[model samples]
Target: MHLVPLIECAGKGFPDGFYEFKNCDSFKLLKEAREKQFVSYLNIGATWKPWHLYRSTLPFTPMSSPFHKLYGHLSDPVRIFTISGEFTGHRIPLSEDLLNARMVMEAKLHNLPEQVDRQYSSTSQSTASTTSLINIVDPETKDEVQFNDPDFRNGIVTCAALSLDGHHVALGFGSGVVELADIDHQHTISRFQLDPPNHPVWIEFVHGSHRVAAEDSEGNVTILSHDMTAANLGNLPSGPLPAVTRVSDNGLFIIRVPRNTDSSWYDSLTLVSILGDPHLQHLAPPSSNNFTPTSNPPILASEPSTSSSASIKSDAVLTIPHRRTLGFSPGAHYIGAFDGLSAFTWSTSSGELISSYRVTDFNLWIMNPAVPFTCSYRIPDPVSPRPTLSLTEGEAAHTHYSETHAGHNLDSSWIKCPFYVLLPSEEEWDELTMLDIHSSAAGRTPLFGTNGKRQRLPVSFNGKLEFIIPKEYEPVVFSGAKGLGAWYGDRVPFDPTFLYSPRSSKDGTRILLQGWQTAPIVVDLSQVI
Candidate 1:
């Protein structure tokens, strides 16, 4: 588990004083755009100025436009910045502000929808100036395509997803309307309304296919294609709405649904297969205190069952509670889920529990189904100074002298180190020790140097097990105020600050890491990992 330092950018990169990276900022790794080497993120600064961060090998160039804020605060002003590289010559106004945006395959088409205001009054002067539009910009030519729908004009966009090939973009609106638009034609290809008109919570384009699945607040999931053809995945039990729907690159659709019990709220990870029978696998870990065993054993994919009804079958069930973090391995061989306490990985092919770990203060974990080990990184505190240098040089020396004179004192600084632990296997936890890897001099090493503390990990955890990182992986870490601090895995138990989650590319080769109050750092996973 080694980390390499890559490119790092500060908030000063933006011309305006919009320096902080807020949680609302959009950070994504483009899957289908022509700029394969670049990653995109949107920053809505404190000054109400919006800036787009497109990271590439080329030097950083400030780009801006006169666009309304996604949230549309009255104070936000329009500004202009230059778009370079593949997006050169594109002078797009931020006016078509996107609540959610995704990259699609490059295509030349016309008749893009006009921007419509969320207020939706044909006569309102204010509404005319603040209409929200979806801008599909060509990465190669910098040409811009805009789409505005009557439904979305009056409503807010809750979520969006792009197809694997990037030819289509699926948008979920606040009005429970899901629209599929063709990137080439810049028009709505298909539209479907959720029966009760519940706001769409999650939307995803199935990987390797054109089918799109969207879930509403009513716990109903509709699977559709670009042509509005519906695929019956079966009915879901009446429970809390799913947190997210993940489509593996292999085209496996998995949903993280919540089930309320007498003791606590638990999550169920349900897997729906497109090719075979609409088999559903339910995985939930047993509650901490309620050890009562159920009459039924954990279900597996290979278990023979005779139920052919349209009703979904619980093919496999685990005792662990359902987690919002759910994912499948690269080849769809395994599924993984994480809660606050632990991470569970299972074999999708055999329906066997592959590995599970009781993470100590889990911040973020990354694993490929093809890989044998799961990598977990944690930061003790984002705001605290590094423990190795927490004290001034003179103070550190004085403290060391005081401790030394007090007769064989043990330094407690190791507890403050950030963690980057590798759990080789689920069964190997007992053999691991925090003290085995701790070094009194570790803080002085290059890995824990000042620059190393600010490095960010590129991989993002989408609650899907599929990752762009390979078996032998090297992750890039950013340095400076915006960089991430990592523990050396020497500390046995520590609380983690889940500040920002990292995102990975579809092919598992690149990652986008958003730091606190800083621009996103894009790292090429192929280079180090």
Candidate 2:
């Protein structure tokens, strides 16, 4: 379907600074499965690899695409999978290094089957009043605990899981250690080691129970189920790598349980949604209506049914080739690998492919939502080197100087941000094409001096882009507003400005939104009458 750009939420002019989208008439919203209480998805951009800079580096040359050193020419044809989303709103940035940071966190936290508690401890110099702690709870006992470790003290916690009853929480780390925490009281329940020929790439908890699943770096999926004693669960090896086996080192691993409950075995299959090729379903059945019937149907005979030629095909296993990547969605729907794209949802009772959708390319890294603001601070610019003074001395002397210029338009509020960084792909360097999520949207705005350099489209919520920044903008200092930034889609040449969360008033008629100039913008998305 053609992508459509939206011009207005309901007509009245869009808030200033934030560009508006020109709605697309050709595209229709895919609402076949959408519901207010239905599936929620969290799209995340993958992390940046260390070599990405070198690969994108050019040799004394100015090229359109950055990675001329690595890709050579093969980069042109390949379309990289990008974008990650969750219920909590946020925007993924264009920086590659930040992307890697998010991915490492997600792989560590989401590789399990059950839901657990999570605690975030930031190391940023900012005070607690600014950067708040994030807590995850167990769905069962309602037990809550702090899951953050000393290692991730300052960094963000991207992925996490709690058991069906909230008995345990599997927390993933950038160091590749999957920490399984018990939520009864604050304590280290047990740490499952995935370090070996295959390191722990992802972790997850089984549905409705404490059964946890962890994927090794080799793409091997190992299920850990609890015994009746309510003790530490043992691992049940599903097999050496199913379709999701291709995601190895440099790949992402995530797990999810089924959320849709309209099936017969809704609780049985624990349908593990694998991100791969949505088109694969069509390839398997030739058509959704096509499936070969078993050679023989099961028969309930009165006289102790005797075995016969071509035994009743009561049990059946059908393998369909499709693409899958590691990801997560509402109701615990998870994609199990880090490679390819498209994720699948299947019927647990019949092992039949139920439905599918294209996963936003971000599964390689983080799965998060937007955060709130706190404070603001500024750093002085470095001094220029003089002829006689050493460069170090000049830098030190100038590092404390403050420069404040008006019209910089730096202050702005961002809302519903799912922060991420831009990193290089597994292959080689290629041009960065920031295609609009609303396909029909216009090309990215050129940054003037860059001569039409394209910016990747920022990930947004319901077509809105949000940025994170400080609550108060003071002078030229860098604001601590690292929350989510928002922008309007469907508008061409969208501004580089950020949008903030909509603040409601006591009367609820006028809504205050963060504006591009770091000021409050009032918008009315809903009908006042």
Tens-digit per-residue lDDT, 336-375, candidate 2: 2111122233321133433332323331222221122111
Give per-residue lDDT, candidate 2, residue 338.
Answer: 16
lDDT of 1 at 300: 26
- Candidate 1 per-residue lDDT, tens place, 1-529, comes to 0001111222213324333433223221111111222332111111211221222212122223111122123211221111111112222111122222221111112232232222233545543333233253221112111213333222344555545444455656545667765543444566777776765656676644356776665666667665655654555654322343556555654545443222222334566555443345665443322332233232222211111111212332232232114555443444555444445444443344433455442323322223222334343332222223222322332342232223111112222221233333354335532211111111211111111122221222222211221111122221111111211001000012212222334543333222221112233323222
State the displacement of the C-alpha of residue 54, model 2, in Å, after optimal TM-score superposition: 33
The lDDT values for all models are 0.34, 0.25
By summed lDDT, the worst window of 10 consecutive residues in model 2 runs over 443-452
